[model samples]
Target: MATAGPTPFDPAAEFDRQVRTLTELGYPKLSGLAPERFAALLEPLRATALTAVAGEAAGEYDPESGRVPFVLVVTRELAPIEETMSRTTLHGGKLPGFVDRSFEPGALERFVATPEARHPGRHAYLILEVERGEEFCGSVPLDAMATIAGRGRSLLTIEEGVALITHFPQVLVKNKCFSLGGSRSGDRRVPAIWISQKAPKLGWCWEGNPHTWLGMASAGDRRATAGSSGS
Candidate 1:
């Protein structure tokens, strides 16, 4: 059989849908609140949604190799009522509830710096906060796979990462790290796409919007290839 074509990925549309869901569920309106306050409300919700979609936390990091390494932290709680409320409201009852956690800012910076230090490819980072005080942050180290292209390791890139996200919208929750991106308005649009995983998916009590911030960039090799062709 012929392979299927790649699915269309619309970060803005997905974000709008989630915001609408949250509005319907009675959560505070994201647009009206201050940036910091809005982020605070969404963090927990993002954690719950991620856990619901990606069972167990699967992450990658190297503590000894770089000045800063990417980290993924997962937390669980007995009850996640707040998480559930956020999920149900945002996803229109399609997601489940989760425990609570908070996403540290700047977590992505650490993740990005790690791979860039050792590899020659470009990369981007996305942070997804879940409903249950949990967080799931990821880094798309573009083109770094070339370093291990023949080493038998699975090559990962930002495009592939975005594709994975397109299929599983729930990797937004889980916490544990420093804050790289400051809480600001322009920061919201830093990435081509951004996702905020909400409650009704995971039940946990906590304030702040647990969300996934998606950042994008061209792979180093791809950029170099394009530059060479143009010359």
Candidate 2:
């Protein structure tokens, strides 16, 4: 018998994967709706279409041109940051996610989108072209922000960060995590995702600080078509 060829990359399958992930993670309950209802909210987005981005790895692709790597991001409108963070998993689901005490109530809400990183404000959507920013490892978040902006890229938002790890837990590996620079609380805290004790963590770092294991995550664009019934 002949060996089977490699599986083709399918955007529709990828979209289904994201929808299934969310439903299995109890996103519907968190969104105060039934699982079927929540899934319905996302079904229309499948028709939004995708421009396939080709890349074998995170840092190998060009962030400035062509279609870059992308991720399906369900925004904060569906779930608060703390709830979303707790839902994220890693280490094969052996560890619970954490939200540092320093965050306090409403602290995360203060982290609004930067002028350069405006999003569609949809409940769920695709982060059209994203980068984990492994190439910026050891670079300060603030400095990396400048470079990302200069290159016309937007930083990843807190919700987007959670969504990335939720769907692609493997991306939160040691020595190659990423910061959510697109969302800022107007001080120095830059929300980031890193491996902690072999489990995924939702934590923060000083914008001016640099860590050998951390880099600033960015995106080429955010795309969400308005649902016929409104977002």
Candidate 3:
């Protein structure tokens, strides 16, 4: 069986698509900005989009490591980053884009520079998929990962982490760690902050999002007190 070659990319179209996504993510404060200003803000992104990176699998999934180690973050919510990196045909796109390229070995360094580039906020967890071995799901900040790498504690390089992210497998939305709704209405929606919750296994699902700011504050205080007293 002959395999198909990579598709071509259109820079003009891909630039427009990315701008639209940023709008949905509530960026640029468009209402107050002049058209020229808004367009100017996007010039760098537009320029970056001119080049396309093809997506390819980069890391080996360890059969022995059942835990997400950091996380098995679902691909959808975390996908905008990948999409911003390459056309959907590459892997994470819902629609096609102009570029037919994949991330090269050092691609993460560039992807991190995109204007709206952000690391997805996901809980640290221990996942038991039953069919698969234990998957450790947690993430330290990028700086933390860098620090670890610099210390030579991890055989995995920062570039390797970027490769893992770029070519992460299509994941299932396994669980929710936070939610919000109006007091009178039962409308659950994404919240602004996930807040820290450390626990064994599924932290988000078990601890849940605290309902009130005061409640969260109290928890923080208690944790602080415990740390101080124990010391």
Whose TM-score is greatest here? 2
Question: Can you write out model 2's per-residue Cα lDDT over 24-62, one digit (the tens) per residue?
Answer: 988999999998899899886776534333343223433
List the global CA lDDT of all models: 0.26, 0.75, 0.24
Q: How do all models score by TM-score?
A: 0.22, 0.84, 0.26
| Candidates sorted on TM-score, descending | 2, 3, 1
Pairs clashing in candidate 2? Answer: none
Q: Model 2 segments beyond 4 Å from truth?
A: 1-7, 51-68, 226-231
> Model 2 residue 131 lDDT?
79
| All candidates: CA RMSD (Å) | 16.9, 5.6, 18.2
